[model samples]
Target: GFKIGGAEVSRKHAGFIVNTGHATARDVLDLIAHVKRVVKAKLGVELETEIRVIGDL
Candidate 1:
């Protein structure tokens, strides 16, 4: 339940991370990476995404 780069892993939905402010691409990426790392390490699940990344952070 931590926030990374101003993005949060939704408590209601593990699949979504919402930007709480003026978060850029890098912010979301950093949050996603952190989330993946933590989730994989703690839960033994690998996260794969089809989400597209656009613009520079």
Candidate 2:
């Protein structure tokens, strides 16, 4: 069990993730992986990210 690299999944929304403080990219990645694992195990759903390229949506 790791410390999640200083990042955490948002309590207000399941689809959102947030930083604890001075977080690094590794923190966010770790938290995202954890969330995906939990969701897959508990809900039987596989999640993927649809990251925006930049300005356009």
Best by TM-score: 1
The Cα error of candidate 2 at residue 43, in Å, is: 1.3
lDDT by residue (tens digit), candidate 1, 5-33: 77887888988888888766777788889
- Regions of candidate 1 where Cα sits further than 4 Å from its true position: 55-57
So what's the TM-score on candidate 2? 0.71
Q: Which stretches in model 2 have alpha-carbon errors above 4 Å?
A: 1-3, 52-57
User: What do the candidate models score in CA lDDT, each in turn?
Assistant: 0.81, 0.72
1-57 in candidate 2: lDDT tens per residue?
234767777778767777778767767766777878988999999998755334421
Candidate 2: lDDT over CA atoms? 0.72
Candidate 2 residue pairs in clash (backbone atoms < 3 Å): none
Error of 2 at 55 (Å): 19
In order of appearance, the predictions have TM-scores of 0.75, 0.71
